[model samples]
Target chain A: MGFFTKLLETSRVKSPWIVHFDCGSCNGCDIEILACLTPIYDVERFGILNIGNPKHADILIVSGTVNHRNAKVLRNVYDQMPEPRAVIAIGACGTSGGIFREAYNVVGGVDKVIPVDVYVPGCPAKPEAIIDGVVLALGKLKEQRTAKDTDSLAAELHQAREFYANRADRQVVE
Target chain B: MSTIIPFGPQHPVLPEPLHLKITLKDEIVTDAIPMLGYVHRGLETLVSIKDLDQMVQVVERVCGICSCIHAHTYCMCVEGILGIEIPKRAEFLRIIWSELHRMHSHLLWLGLLADAFGMESLFMHCWRIRERVMDVMEATAGNRVIISINKVGGVRRDLSPDQLRWIAQVLDELERELDAIKPVLTNDYTVKKRTVGVGVLTKEQAYELGAVGPTLRGSGVAQDVRMTGYGAYKFIDFEPVVEKDGDSYARTMVRFRELYQAIDIVRQLIRKLPDGELSVKVKAAKPEGEIVCRSEQPRGELLYYVKGNGSKFLERVRIRTPTFANVPPLLAMLPGIEMADVPVVALSIDPCISCTER
Candidate 1:
């Protein structure tokens, strides 16, 4: 492996930039997520930056239940992130669809669309649990970036790059 | 030419997904239309499947910030329909939890507003104080955010004298910290620059647009549903915090003053802590009636309507949250304001989209 790739892999575990997306949650999990950034819970000490843009993020932190309408949006966000990205499903709704699982127009957990690496379970998961979940995601992120994982990783990146290139080509043709 | 700029569904200023379509004429906003339903979990419709007791848990999840009050108001509605009177001690406990919820909600709003205008230290300071309230909540009720203390007839838990004393001590410390930071919030140059003379909603406009809570109180209307005397509020003596300016600054002041009001109310409830049974044993008999219940939530007045047939499950449950009522005024206030001030102006109403769309 190249020295730069190894450097990037190790640095990712130390500092993981994450984008938080609320699919269809009661603001409970969302607030708890925000609380983690505040002075008391302050997840920043671990170098976890709450980056707003999905493209700039290394970890995707999703909260709440995924509804039918937002399912596409969630997929688009996941697709926008570069390969080796990890997803942390925070709160019960994001993990297995807590209380609103049976509701009409609800698509259950976030795993319905994208791959989730870590699951933090709570009605609205506490900030402590959320931080722990992110730390867990960082471990998965490091594993995904390892030399042994690159074979399957290269295949997924090839397909994603092709999909983007085809879409760009289509736009130019139009 | 007027161009449209869409904000949110995932903006930093908003915790929940609230989309705003702003039509701007150069630097000024010509019109603003808010589109909701991003966080709608269809909780109200779950009444058909979950029984009335289980539905409290569902209702509590409608908005996590105001979970205690949502459960409190829903239980009040069911109790009203059943005509069951709760014990005196439970009423006092309910008031204590509700006021604590109000303190944390206001502090959360204050911190967010500070963060919106780029006041990082002020945001940190506010949340620091807010943590104290959350600690008291955790020490007493077990959870930090959703206390889940409110039950059908009364409350699920009780506090000992020592715990109550610890709460009073913590509240005293909170008040001292708030005093140190009060000037920064009220008289700071940046806070004043962003909030003062912005988003002015006249009394008539606020009334016509159906604004409620601090949004209504900020407009000089002095209209608080707490004056209606539900729960233990009838026993406590208090008045709504009103500011006549009707600007963003005025709304901010209304919430700022309310933080102290909540503290005072909690103090009063603790002092007059009554002695009795915690909750009356409610029969699991199916309810048959239509009832409307109202309670003063931290954001504003929450109105809950429950229709029950002779079944364990309720037929219908509808909630009209304060944010839903306050959004129209936000739309009215958006135009004629600079594009840069839109976030603070929208936040001035303390919009909670989860509750609004629930």
Candidate 2:
């Protein structure tokens, strides 16, 4: 709705600095993402840079099944990124835990950790779908300017700390 | 000041998840501690529930890039369980497919390493060659990746004469082009400065840490899983590739030589292929026993331990990926290295966190 907001959204669409994280995935999805960055797909031409630091990233691309052990670390990373941030769950495992859902260690899906803006579904979602999901995230970022003004990630992080501190409260009151 | 840095269990650069606590004293690694058990999916459990027929698919999905090798190794284990002899044609095809996967995987590693160092154009060029390998995978397996071609007794897909010839020809081109490109990777001042002499893993250190694949090969060891002669490896002749320097450059050179070796092995396989049944009808029942079979993945030696109950489901499955073996070495090497050199040194072991985690 605002001038700088519109400009930032447009630039974000054109220049998405992505930080890719692997919660726990078979490299199938990781390699496909690598393919998109390579010359054959060349998603980088659109200025989708893979940044090493999470603090500066606008798009968070995650692959693999989120396991119980990594759920906290995943939330912590999602909390670290600045506002106007978007999460793209890449691969079947990331979206819904895929083949490994029934396993004891599997965490079911990435959304269980944080809200996902887009989901690219495939055993190993092809590079093209990954790009499309990113494009969709940018569009959503533009539309959500006035939808929710609060910093949800920070709030979630705060809530998480409380949930852990009062672990005894989870037991039966009776 | 002593600084602590965490690597993986969830981090960039590793497709798998292994938590490494690295301690550095002003850029020199002082000590490294590794924490594992992240991607443990109870693969052994799945193997028991599924018959040999179905487990073939499961093994291939274990790691996408190395799908063919897992399938091949599983096939070897199964053939051992049942007294079945694979046809020479099937054996040749298996070898050809494995080598192609190696070529593609090594190139993928080369590009990522280059990209890590901020060599954008060079990275792009390496991946362009990778596309050719993917094309071959697509043409044969009907999937660019996760080929899913390896089956119980033999391969699921049969290679036509034209496909075989095309594969050999394509590999020839890739070999030539990759050879010409070697100078750029080796001679370039930046790559040398970034990689050479950094992350030096002495031969004894490598052995002590249980390093495998090019990581071990770089440390002056001549060990490779292929020497075990699983699949069609017995028929197709090849030698273990090694470099004595035990630095990042030596590791790079090992991959380079192995790439050419992979090409040659494929060419010989296609030429010597004896025609017959590509896949035999597999009877899957709860076989009573446990077995372990492994092969050299692009990263290193990968072992799959399977324990099967008399029931349809597997009792236990444990995978020891090469990345796990290299972790201790990585921790050892990480200390005494500059912060800037961490990724380069880390990647030199070709970390596949997913495989480790899984």
Candidate 3:
């Protein structure tokens, strides 16, 4: 790898700016995500900061299930992030929709609309578990950088958009 | 020029997903429209999907900050429909846990409030103290955020005298820390300047808008659902904290005083802890009635309506959360405030979007 490429990889690992999105959660996972930033869990120690803007984020942490109303918005957020981005699905709801999967409005988990690299599973997912998920995402980021899989990533994003648009359209039809 | 600025669905000040469309005339907000349904998971509709007995887990997850009280109220409602009386000891245990939940929630809110106003150290201090409350919760109920202890007839777990003593020690430590920080939140000049007279909701306005919890109490309305005394609260003696200022500062003061009130409530519950069964032997009979249950949450009063149809599944379950009730008053507070103070005034109501949309 080139020296500049190596430096860029190391910088991404050192400082992963995260954007947290609440798709349709119970606030269980959302509070736990905030708890990760506080002194006790302090994910910032790992150089992870929760930013509010998707344009500036390298990691996307989503809590809760994706519903028909939010599926397109979630897809739009994923598409806004720059390449080599990793998505971390936090909590059981985000991972597999949890108990809300059967609800009429829900379209299941974050993976329903985007490609999730790390799945942190808990009712709210412990702060420790979330920190571990970020670390795992860093590894995924390195792998994605090495493979230079922008084409496949683009394809995946395209597929996700189409799927959600269809889901929204189906909801309207019903 | 009047400019329309979208405040959120995603914003730094709001930790949750809430969208506000604020129309600005120069620096002052002319009109503010809040758009809901961002985090609507349709949880209330899951009553038919999950059985009545298993629905306690679903209700508890409605909002992590007040999970214990949610479950407590749901179980109380179900027990009411089934006509079963919970043991006195169980009632006291419920109070202790619920009070602990309220303390952690208020501390979390205080930290968020400090962050909203750019007081970083104060935010850290509030969260640092909040961790102690979480530790106490984990020690007693085995989970920090969602203490899934309540069941249909009563609570699921029993605390020993030794565990009770340990919780008391933690509460004592927390009270000392809160006493040290209370002054900074209540009397600090910057806090007062930013909050005082920023979002004044007159007593009449608060009543007409259906504000509950600290939002109502801050407006000089001494009404609290705890006064209804569902559980062991009936035996406890403590007055609701009321401030007549009806601004952001008043709301902060109400929550600050409530921290002590929660601690005192927990202590009283422990001292008056009775001896009996942890839960009654709930009979297996399909409930055939409808009941509405109300409980005081850290944010405000939460109402749950359950309709049973003599089957395992419930007919309908509706939840009216405090944030939903406070949103109208929040809109009323925003129009006259400066653009920069939008977050501070919004945070004052402690809007839990997930709770509101759920």
Candidate 2, TM-score vs. the true structure? 0.91
lDDT of 3 by residue, B121-188 (tens): 88889888999988888888998788899988888899999999998999899989988987887679
- List of chain A TM-scores, every candidate: 0.84, 0.81, 0.83
Q: TM-score-based ranking, best first?
A: 1, 3, 2
lDDT of 2 by residue, A29-145 (tens): 888888898889988789998875777888888887888777776786777677678999998889998777766777788988899989999877878888899899888776665
- Share of native interface contacts present in candidate 1: 0.52
Which pairs clash in model 1? none
**Candidate 2, RMSD to the unseen true structure:** 5.0
How well does candidate 3 match the true structure in TM-score terms? Answer: 0.94
Output the lDDT of residue B261, model 1: 93
CA shift of B331, model 2, Å:
2.8
**Candidate 2 iRMSD in angstroms:** 9.1
Best by DockQ: 1
B278: Cα error in model 3, Å: 0.7
Can you list each candidate's DockQ?
0.42, 0.33, 0.38
Off by over 4 Å in 3: A149-174
TM-score of chain B of 2: 0.93
